[model samples]
Target: MVVVKGQDTSEPGGVPAHPAASASADAGDEAAEDDRRPSPDDLHELLAERGLAPDDVDQMVDVAAVGITARWWRNTKVEDWHAGSAIGALSDVDMYRINTHTTAKVRERLRRWRREQGLHTMVDVADADPAPLNRVFYNLYRWFTNPNRTLIIGTTLRDVVAQTLSNARTHPDCDVPDNVTTETELEDYDNQVAGAAGYLLESMDEYDPRSVLYSPALFATVWARRWWGLPDYPSHVDRVFAVLADPGHRTWQNRPIPPPPDGVNLVDVRKKMLTKPWELPDSVCQWLINDAAEHYIFD
Candidate 1:
């Protein structure tokens, strides 16, 4: 929600034309007003003063400072979502950082936003047996806050689509147990995953396995956000693809995707996925922005 510029301050049952409707307002004052807003560093001090955990004030707020308010493409919930989730991860001492880091006052307010009525998907990477990381390749992905989460990836490329299908069919309980299945059997593996995704698509009546693939890569985020009452979904689909396409994505790093096996329409696969509906929390955008500005998510 947003207040329009030059909108009337008066509310029918809301605030009196003057100012007494604030939750933290004083007797004579309707709402609290500050002469000057605090800077990111100042906000850290405010949260520290209020007893918030140091991580909330220092790291999270520091991370959030990367975002500049975008009024044009309005999306209040996205920013609100960050404020609520970050503050919830803080210690009581650092609680005020919500006010310091962002304009939100409600500690866990974003958890139950009714606007979350739309369908979405998520993939939890369940500590799959990754091949290996190169020297320059950092296991750059992992949830520091919530360790037990899954990650997902979307692809209908012949190899990827087939493998997703096989995953659903051959290994009915694919994710339940973690194992290193040899890619030595690439053809057989692709056939399996393809079968799985295909099977799920056939049954629209039940939960589609598509949800699993479409919404991959938010394991660490979804669980933590879920704890705070917010649905772990991105504000838009392009965000999902941007992340999936990133060189840091596991799919790109795990094992180089071999050139689309002979005659596999790579163009069609890319178009299909790029045009498909996907969602992800705006925190990732904030991250890219932060990285661009601060050199990285953390110093």
Candidate 2:
């Protein structure tokens, strides 16, 4: 799938459709990674089995509005005036390094981060946690037309949940739902992303008949995550990650996907990540916290 610049609407045919990633581009090369990630189909089946779907937004306007709302929720605190950071960084204990974090560790940590931080929504997220995710959301959310940050796991639901919980937790008065289990179901990073893919599949398929809840534009966001950067980009990360970290998007860069280490166990990996104790710039980390104050009127 080729991403076209300035074409933000993810309506039908808004973006180019390459064959689904489950299929491969190169027939002869085993090295060529055929979007081995689970297809939306497989995920939809899982969601259906679990009985879930999108709320069904009314129109493209509605899609963009909800999308924008979610992003706005994330970015309410990009500036440093309210942030307590002397130079705009979270304290040493609060800083969570994206790299060096094992996939195994990220998943459990992501969920736990949410539970401890209280980040179900923006208000809750900012009121308490105040991490960098909000800033990135604000910077990248181009009226939700740009799926730069708002996919199932990559940006939309998962990003909000993960960022809120992980950055520093979100709400204080808001208690985690009694039904919401703090247990760790999926531990692997790939598995977390995979579960998101599955949820998106179910959401899109069911909402196709009569709603704006899950529009085609979302697929574009998904496409971008799978997007292969040109040869010029870094080897480990794709272009999107690079773009977020680019000079222009510095405030939005936040944490990285963590470095990939071969043959590392979870316990050992967490030990290593904790040792570094680094996050994105301090200014970026506090955006969520500040924004939450404004939105949720956090005390």
Candidate 3:
């Protein structure tokens, strides 16, 4: 059997049709093409699998209206906004990213990053726990389009949840869900990012200067952990080891790390953890942080 972009192109008697002929045949078969497309029922079934009610689509639209700033969604397209259902919005997002000038290498990095952040599809958003309906709507809309901050450091779903929880901790008026993330989960996530930062610090010289690690577009990534409330390396390193020492701890189950030298069995360490700690001079690090804060993160 011959396959092109996942479509079977084999003809009768095990002979493969010419690629152009196959394309022409497929394009001419309107009823077959329509059959191939997902129906409203199919979309509803997908959402239902994640426990979302049909009305939840409206909630998703409202969230996207507020959270998304892209011109495609925000300006002169209000009709299109309402016309496009939740799944259509996701499809539009996918197409926009495909049409953008982002390099293939960067797109692959972003794909991996999104997978790491626990975002793969609308279903994944609906599956995030703790009041999955509302929280899922938030996740769906927040990640529906690529935010500029997404390319910045410290924008993981865990980081966002932790930050929201921390803000609520510091300020009583912060409007966040009561069960978005527990304090224990917050601390666990903090340690995970810190250990990743420590790993990056240990592996800095191993990367080439031309690599994404040194790219100005992602300069803020070097200090992502700090932006997400891990302020100092020594303290961060201490937390990492502290988490490591607790064999029963919950931090490494999802984000695994290397086992301790003392034969303490631990989860397998994944290659090239995404966290990056600055190896630059203090002055340069300060400047980069200030620049990102002033011009990138908040803008």
Candidate 4:
């Protein structure tokens, strides 16, 4: 990152013309040092050297401001703004009082200073993956588009129930009642199945029923606390299975067999079973089988 400085007049030859040019070259060297990654301690040291107090720094600088100018500079293909320019923006008096503010505050101030210098984006200083900065950009973008808009977690128990019903309906062997259309109807069905599963789980305590639900290949682990009884335990297990079944869910594992319309043949499904057996109840497997069958048509 080259720091732009005032152009110096050079002699007719390639050499610098005067002693002032030598001083400028030295300042450029210092500026190069300033171009290194900025940290809280460095900012504090720079301010203390300048004799700025905390209150003085805050009054002159908006420490909370994002480094927009720095980002803009980088985006526009301008000379990189180094720390020297960031500190140089402050008045000598304000610069002297930099120690009074917290490190975080000073960091923000420096970031903002970089922004004021025409660096408007976070990517200007970002050394590696700009994911965090990208998120900030996204939030700002969202805010600008709709000030009243707020993010909400869309997943709900109703959604889980609906997903489970969808899975059952698509399964080759599982029997799903026709009347279970609405979310309310699905929830009732889920409750019934979960109750039965819970009873079975409790009765068969000698066997770790979870072994059936645990698929190492799928990276699926349905955890339940010891204190949780049948209905709750079964309900949670159903939820986990439902999540795994839906590709729309983030936790859904990618399978060699795609979803319906393409329709995977039984041979491929059997192959998948051998490699990564579905760790779910027989009832759940019925839905998975039906779902997998939809992905491809059999000969």
lDDT of each residue in 1-299, candidate 4, tens digit only: 11123423221111011111221222223323323322333333443353333223232233222112111111111111112323112222221121112222323544454455443332233222233333433343333223132212122324433444455455454444566454444333333223222322222232222111111101101111210111222344345445545667543345543342334454453444333333223333444435443212211
Question: Can you give the TM-score per candidate against the true fold?
Answer: 0.16, 0.19, 0.18, 0.16
Ranking by lDDT: 3, 4, 2, 1
lDDT of 1 by residue, 1-299 (tens): 11223444221111111111221222222223323222223433443453333232122222222111111001112121122222211222122122222212111121112113221211111121112211101111111011232212221123332233344334323221233222322333233223222221222112322211111111112112211111212223334345434667554544432333345353443343233212222332232233222111121
Q: Output the worst ten-in-a-row residue range by lDDT, candidate 2.
A: 73-82
| Alpha-carbon deviation at 24 in model 3, angstroms | 20
Residue-by-residue lDDT tens digits, candidate 3, 1-299? 11123333332210002111121222123333332223334434543453334234232222222211211121211112112232112222222222121222233443344355565443443333323222322333344332322422224334433443454455433333455454444333333223222222222223211111111112222212222111232344345445645545564445444333443222221110112222223333333233212113220
Query: lDDT tens digits, residues 222-272, model 2?
Result: 332211111111232333334423545444345433322344353442233
Give the clash count for each candidate: 35, 22, 0, 34
Off by over 4 Å in 1: 1-34, 39-42, 49-58, 61-299
- Tell me model 2's lDDT, rounded to 2 decimals: 0.28
**C-alpha RMSD of each candidate structure in angstroms:** 25.5, 21.2, 24.9, 32.5
Candidate 3 least-lDDT 10 residues: 12-21
Poorest lDDT segment (10 consecutive residues) of candidate 4: 212-221
Candidate 2 Cα outliers beyond 4 Å, as residue runs: 1-187, 207-292
TM-score of 4: 0.16
Candidate 2, residue 78: how far the Cα is off, in Å: 20
